[model samples]
Target chain A: MKKNHSGVRIGEVTLKWFIALHLSLIVNSLAGVASKMAGKQKFLSFRFCICYGMVLVITFAFALAWQQVLKHMSLTFAFTNKPITIIWGLIWGVLVFHEHVTWKMILGSAVILLGIMVGVSGDSGSDGSSLPPEGGKGDV
Target chain B: MFEGLGRYIAVWIVSVFISSIAQVMLKMEANREHASKLKEYMNPMVVSAYFIFFLSTFLTMYALKYVPLTYSPIIEPMSYIFVPVIGVLLLKEKISRRRLIGMGIMIAGIVIFSM
Candidate 1:
């Protein structure tokens, strides 16, 4: 892969990129669901371990997918789309966890959706590089 | 001082901000070149980033004991606000007008979501 003068490669937006982003979000949200399930068990108990194990696995997938996302999109674009995970959370809550949602929560989610749409508007073929010109490198 | 929804928001904010920092670290780790591709994983910064990310995930789960799944999503946007600020301050990445606008809108959405 060839990097530009800025040492960052430009991304070409494609259907595969979109699909990967959504898949990442879905897997990321599942980590939350798994965590919630783990909360019901005693810490480090058999049940807790199983639930937490699921969290770890799902999170591993999320991290891997997120790296792919950053390769193809800017952090701003990638983070902006993260709110979609809320919808997935709500779905899991309603369908799997049987959690209740109030009307206000629905309204707030709608506004968040609007904001996500506006945030991503006209972002295609734009400055999607992940690194700056003068980069910082060190271990923390 | 924080309790109920306020506490959940606070925890979520911390988690997302830390996660964004980890994101930047991973991106930096990605930029470096190594003879052995697997050696990249051994970079201290990358390892630190993943460790920080693990802590963030733990905090998220801890907060879930108090927060419902539906409400937790509202806090996810906090990273959108945080990542750009850190990008500018730490990474010195340039921000475009459109991105600024998008971030502004996202902030507005967060405010409304918090209500």
Candidate 2:
């Protein structure tokens, strides 16, 4: 019974982390979308101010959530996950910007997705082992 | 300052570097335990990091105005490369072999996608 309970707890924790990580990614991508939208307006115009202001607010949210993610994951893994935004950007481009995706782009995105899976799977360590002690010299 | 391709590359790299610094600073901020107060948001490191990031963003926008179609592909992924290296040197983040390979594959994928 104890073993079964522990396994359930682990599953719960994994699910919680999965939700948190993806939330961060989506929010980060939204910030990019906001910034891109802001770029379309004239600088210092009221519309520009509104769009850019939204960007700032959304970016603050992204930063906060990203910090939270780093608390649970290693810097290396988190940093590597930065490329995931590219996939989001492509999706946004197609849906929002009406951009076309060529075959090369699709193949490349698939490779990137594969890479993210490999990277995330390589680490079972909960506490980012690659993250060094604060202000401590890293052995590299 | 954005006339030539070389200058554009320089500006793009500088912007990426600044962005990487911001990334590291945010990571450092994350590792700390702070109270939920206005003062916490006013932390000097966090503020400066944001300031630098804003500057980087502005420079990128400006640089793009001059060379948007030509260099956008390569320049965008430069940060993915920069952050990990900066994270290692300045932030003392270690990289395992598997993670390194993963990063390489991701980067190659991005380069291809951008192309």
Candidate 3:
């Protein structure tokens, strides 16, 4: 049980890593957008392939950025913070798909976000938030 | 509900649930020792987990046809609730009070979002 505290303040150690995490999440949610576009196309069709291919591309980019973020931050913090993508997802829905956003939906998302924050707050008792030992292998 | 896209919605939720199971399966497999690094991921458990993930990705694409991107994110968070419950039921893991509250709040959100 160790708290690898370099004493700079936890959670988003640097603005650079914070940007990296948010960027990865933003790009990753676009994979859902591409998948949705793929769904609209006929299966095995060229358009479907193109859209799904875009999903793969976006996911690959996200994976690279995510690795950098994980190298800096903790997985528990990263996972719990992923709901930010929901906001991006909502924006993409309205902008790309012309989907309607109602007050109920906003309220519901708010509650979920609040609940997740509560859960994260409670997760601090253990050393679960720390990264694995430096140079630990099998990163794949 | 969902303008009779119930079947696709069902498929999407099931895929999410299955993928979370795959995560657990991978964790369980990783906890075990393997003769070699290649054998670690090449073994039946890990291979099956990846296969499940692959199939679920396709299922997600299929389900996205009827499920709008807007509602998809709302529903997708359900996996946050799924993983811990699976851990408790299968691995006999204990739950913390905050997580239970979090799940309860998320359930409330889901019900509200659905209605």
Candidate 4:
């Protein structure tokens, strides 16, 4: 019984870590996209080139970290938790873009958040356990 | 003004959906293709070089043109959020009661978070 409970706890922790890693991906991707859209064309300015390079480097680093994380976690859990970035994006939009938040948008985000929580909570099996082998081909 | 906002939103949605499909298809293709050629695929030196070239040449260009950088990443998460909905509609997958409840709670949380 104790072993079973511990296993469940470990799974929950893994899910939370997966969510955080995905959040990093979303935030970093947004930053990269914003930089590019700001007219930081390639080879235009030395500083812009440096910034773009840095973004690429950091994104690659995060991709590596994510590959490591996936080794111990289920893809379903990881992928399901990834959608929380939509909620984060909404937050960023309000703060950065000064977009108005409508009730409908709010409701939609709530449904997504609730769905992720419940999805993670209900899973207790070893389905989707076939993780891609470690140090395999990875992407950013 | 109404039409303008609607257009923007529609374009955003369509672009994101296409990109999502692209991502999934790429992953699926890469996995299936590489499994048979594991020796070549697992060659990290080659894969890293390929990834860098692919991102800079293909993925980045399409992404920047169709979707604003700032918003694209945020919207990328929608792929996951909508997967179940897609499964239900297109694949005829069943949603259990627990999943329904979870979906409801997620909707509520998203509302609060957005505000």
User: Interface Cα RMSD for all candidates?
Assistant: 5.8, 6.9, 5.5, 6.8
DockQ of each: 0.28, 0.26, 0.48, 0.28
Highest DockQ against the true fold, candidate: 3
lDDT (tens digit, per residue) of candidate 2 on B1-115: 6568568667766876777777677677867888777656689887887787778765654454344322333445555456667888876877767767867886787778667
User: Which 10-residue window in model 3 chain A sums to the lowest lDDT?
Assistant: A131-140
Sorted on TM-score, best first, the list reads 3, 1, 2, 4
Off by over 4 Å in 4: A1-11, A14-26, A32-59, A102-104, A116-140, B1-3, B27-77, B81-115
Global local distance difference test of model 4: 0.48
- Model 2 agreement with the true structure over A72-96: per-residue lDDT tens digits: 6566556545546656756776676
**Chain B TM-score, one value per candidate, order as shown:** 0.87, 0.77, 0.90, 0.41
How do the residues B1-115 of candidate 4 rate in per-residue lDDT, one tens digit apiece?
A: 4275345444445544544333433343444434456654565544554454444333343344433333432244344345445545644645666666765665565455445
CAPRI quality level assigned to candidate 2 from its DockQ score:
acceptable
In model 3, which regions exceed 4 Å deviation? A1-12, A125-140, B1-3
lDDT per residue for candidate 1 within A14-79, as digits (tens), equals 556767888877877787789888877788899989998998888767767777777886665665
TM-score of 3: 0.86
Superposed by TM-score, candidate 3 places the C-alpha of residue A108 at a distance from the truth, in angstroms, of: 0.5
Clashing residue pairs, backbone N/CA/C < 3 A, model 1? none
Q: Which tens-of-lDDT digit does each residue in A6-71 have in candidate 3?
A: 533345556556677778788888888898999899998999999988877876777777778878
Highest lDDT: give the candidate number. 3
Decoy 2 TM-score against native: 0.65
True contacts kept of each: 0.34, 0.27, 0.47, 0.36
Q: Residue by residue across A1-140, what tens digits does model 4's lDDT show?
A: 12353353344454346456676556444543443433335554676566555655655665676676666666655545554545655666566555566666666665665566565446443543121111111111
